[model samples]
Target: MLPPRLNDGGRTDLDLATLRRATFGLKLGAGVTLISLAIVEKLANPEMARAMLEQEPLLNLLAPFGVSADAFAVVAGSVELLLGLLVISGALPQVVAILTAVPFTATLALFGATEFLGHLPLYGVLLSFLVLGSLEETSHSLSGLRRRAGVPTH
Candidate 1:
């Protein structure tokens, strides 16, 4: 059940263009926050960091990225957090979301591809799909940013 707002801006009509920006923006923020937090914990304490990354499937794939488990956790986490906040607060969410996601998506997809090529398994593919599918959230945030930036909606 969806919660109704009392303000009453009757029959919500969502513009597809606006929806795309909003979705993209939110996804970027969430992803960045998640990654950044993980990296922070790993950096603060090596042992605890090791233990944390051990549970994430990404640990096994870290070697190809040239970052050690501890380093990978810390780096990935910090980067994600920073990126997430930027996406959420950027002045041009629509443009930023599209710009950032392109590289972000490529990095993940490349890693996934490397995993596949290295004979890892199906997990990489699944992770890639998950990462790619979340772009809609990025779009949402981007839409808000776009409106805030005075970008015209279709």
Candidate 2:
């Protein structure tokens, strides 16, 4: 059974546009926080960042191909940074969200139930963004970064 708050107050006069805008803002905040933490972990603590990749299953798989732990950390950090910018700007949000969830999902498999439980809310946010699709207005995102960059909003 869904929570009572999940319903639209059982009202027919709900403003869906406002609801969507609010959700988008929420997603933006969540994405920014997640990315900021990742950048901090990557930039502030190189040893710990490399150690995390070393502990993941991906390292075992990629090690055979000569991908070192440090290399993996650098690559992962770069991808996260790029995806973080796209997500914050609301550019290709669905794609960005899916990409964002890949590492979280991997962590679930690598670390088991505890990690899964911890990241469940983040996974939910990513899934929500995927289902909600892209935002209609790009101007409100990143102070019109897309427009300023000559990127097509559509």
Candidate 3:
């Protein structure tokens, strides 16, 4: 299928359908990872959460708020869990993607180059989500193709 033309009357060969599928995969992957990490830090291994809070950057960030490390950990975990659920559910994905990006960007800034390099793949996915917006139902799937071709399904 020929790619659609842009509003500016410019033409390109980008396969939007394939791009959307790739974005969905990225979103699902990030969501699952976030949920799993949240569960592990908050429940499966509380000690790890405590140790994470002891990191210099986190300590500095939390110092002004007078919030206890444990409390911060709980709140952070809860936020991650909620964000993961929202992302996976495809609820306001563009907005959720931005929301997710804020903290991720902050963490990258806080930790500097090492983290920035390590999280390059995640950054790409987040950028793709921001640019692509929400995933819409497309008629390119097998079921849709079959329906379009007047094929009977049992």
**Candidate number with greatest TM-score:** 2
- Model 2, span 22-84: residue lDDT tens: 556765777687678667877556788777766664644467788877666667777777766
Model 2 collision count: 0
Question: Which RMSD values do the candidates have, in order?
Answer: 9.6, 6.1, 7.9
Worst 10 residues of 1 by lDDT: 120-129
Error of 2 at 144 (Å): 9.0
Could you tell me the lDDT of residue 116 within candidate 1? Answer: 45
Error of 2 at 54 (Å): 4.2
Segments of candidate 1 deviating more than 4 angstroms? 1-36, 55-60, 90-154
Whole-model Cα lDDT of every candidate shown, in order: 0.50, 0.65, 0.65
TM-scores, each model vs. reference: 0.38, 0.68, 0.67
lDDT string for model 1 (59-122, tens) is 4356786767867666655655565565445444445445445434544554676644543322
Instruction: Count clashing residue pairs per candidate.
Output: 28, 0, 0
Per-residue accuracy of model 3 over 116-148 as CA lDDT, tens digit each? 897687677566665555323322221122133
The model with the greater lDDT, 1 or 3, is: 3
TM-score ranking, high to low: 2, 3, 1
